[model samples]
Target: MTRRYVIVGNGPAGVAAAEAIRRHDTAGEIRIVGGEDTGFYSRPGLAYLLTGAIPEESLFSRPASDHDLAGIHRTVGTVREIDPQRHRIVLFDGQAMSYDRLLLAVGARAVRPAVPGIDLDGVVTLDNLDDARRILRLARRAKRACVVGGGITAIELAEGLAANGVETHYLMRGDRYWGSVLDPYESALVEGRLAEEGIRIHRGVELAGVIGRKGRVAAVETRDGSTLACDILAVAIGTQPRLELAHLAGLQTGRGIWADATFQTTDRDIFAAGDAAEVLDPETGKRGIDSLWSAALDHGRAAGEQMCGVGRPYRRPAPFNVTRIGGVTTTLIGAVGTGARDVDLVTLGRGDSNAWREHADAFAVVSDGEANHLRLVLGPDRLVGAVVMGDQALSRPLQHLIRERVDIRWARDRLSRGPIEVRKALQALIERTVPLGAA
Candidate 1:
């Protein structure tokens, strides 16, 4: 009997799941439903598109011919509801598709906060390719652009606006940039770099409302009674999982739609993945979405395998994200921000290593005078979390140590000595764990 597998998205996760299903169940019916008409494209590449690093037409993850070759059926419609009892999903257009197994990988939607004049013509979000095109059009005559929010997306938007020769103002509700992930020291380093790039930083200010002139955004009004002139307003606060269909399906949900390690939902036949799925950590019993591109791809593959009767749990290392913003390479590994107050933080400051800077510049161009800071989150006796800024050489080793739960007790004294000796200490610890020949 040919089993039917229905994937309710066309993003990285959903596409990966479909391909995996085809690989395992060669004769099974595989269908991918996407609300967007376009095929899969790189969401991360949207930022580069703003700076002309990539052409608008080059965002697709794969060629148009590939989906047909894979024997996957693609549909354009939103999954409005999941009727698990009937083993079918109802589309927004009232079309119902039945499946032996269903995967919900609908991803997330970008948010625009409710404020006066927010519906004005000049205010837009760069969530999808369409939004990117809209922003590109607006950027042509935009002189002063104000980006609201303190997340990575907001920072990237601000950088893109500045790169396009527009005067950029990064308005954050908090006093520090990325305060959730960065400490005072780390935040200062980022703040200084942004200032050097002529991107004005306004912190601890609440966005009271947006002011418009003749149906177009003219200025941004703050709660403190100050209004900053702006030709465009871009908001990149954060993202919430698209879980309306999951809720309608009567699936248990928390941060996102709850699924077990195998991506199995409340109904054994229904699975979930991508930004929409809050997978439970088998070890800790915690349910949350990793929301990373790599994580989503892996989850889809694992879920696909499980659906094919190859039982294996989807296990992932602690979450990490690396990005170069404002000419500074920043890497956040593990639960760096969530439990910072509980762990022992080791701060190492390396003030302008000319040699190190040159080495790193080859990979990613950073600010000329930006200082490097490496901080490790040590829990009990093992390396757990790390924040690498300016210099990313330590990012890989730190990630490995955290993932492997390697003990760094032998380098405790050397680590406390500060920046100069910290690298040596890490090298020593690595050499000890690894054989001499391997080192």
Candidate 2:
């Protein structure tokens, strides 16, 4: 029998799964149903689009013709419901489709706070390409903009808006930026860079409510009874997985749809992947949720193989992401937090996985007294995690050391001596231990 495959949410995970399935089962009937108007585009590049760093055409990852060439059928509509027992899905427009296997890669959406006038015309989020376009349109007329959040998305918005000539005011609920991930010195470095770019940083402020005039954002009221003049109010408060469909279809879920090591969900025939899959971590005995693009791509491919009866147990790699934060190219690998916790900071990051916070241990910080910064999380016998900011000469090496858990027991004492000694030791260790073939 020709296997009929139906995948939901045509983003990176869904699209990657379709291609992977096509590679293995040449005759499988693969249909990708998505709600977005456009095809797959680089979600991370949306920041570049806002800042005019890259042309709009550069945002797309897979060309539309690639899917057609691969014999993958694409449909656009909102999925009204999924019937697992019936092996079918119904779209919002009343169209129904059945499949032998179903993959849910619905991804996630940015959360909007429950503030008065939040639904105003000038209030927005940069969740999708459409949201980025809307933000650009608003930036044209926006004189002053206020953004609240403590992660990468919030920084991207503030930077993009400032680049667009809008006087941007970034509101931090805590003392600094990204407190959950970046330490005090790291946060200060990012704050200093953003300040140089003309972004006003307001610390220890929370959005009490948004004030709208004529059905558009005119100002925002802080918790301290201060009203700031604002034409645009952008919110990048964490993201939540689209789990309503999974819940309604009788699938068990916690932070996301629960999935086994093979990416198989509670139901054998249906699978979950990407940001929506709360995959089990056998090592930690906890379910892991990821909002990273690379995680989605890797999981989607492995999930496709599982659907094809390959039974490839998805091997979740150590989390790694390289991004420009506050105008500094930063690379984060594994876990780098120095046991610092911030409830105000959103636990989930837009470009990071919540799993990075799973292992927090002893760490050391090194800097060049400028924008360049490096921090290493140490384990008893190996390197656990790292954060490389500014100069990234050590980024890939750090990732390899942490990911492979290379032994550093010989140099643990020397590492704690000081910054200069630690740098020399890590440079020599990376050169000696890491082979060129290391992934």
Top-scoring candidate (TM-score)? 2
Candidate 2 residue-wise lDDT, 1-439, digit = tens: 9999999988888888898999999999999998898988999999999999998889887899999998999999988988988999999999999999999999888888888988999988888988999999999988999998867899999999999999999988888788778878888889999999999999889999999889999999999999999999998888888998898789999988999988999999999999889998767677888888888988889899889998567767778888899999998888776555654455475897775676565666565547688888787788877888888878887888887788889878877677878888887787788887652
**Per-residue C-alpha lDDT of model 1 across residues 284-338, encoded as one tens digit per residue:** 7767566567777888888888888785897767776777766687777775653
TM per candidate comes to 0.89, 0.97
Give candidate 1 regions above 4 Å deviation. 338-371, 434-439
Tell me the number of clashing residue pairs for each predicted model. Answer: 0, 0
User: How many backbone collisions does model 2 have?
Assistant: 0
> In model 1, what is the error at residue 147, expressed in angstroms?
1.0
Score each candidate by Cα lDDT.
0.76, 0.86
lDDT of 2: 0.86
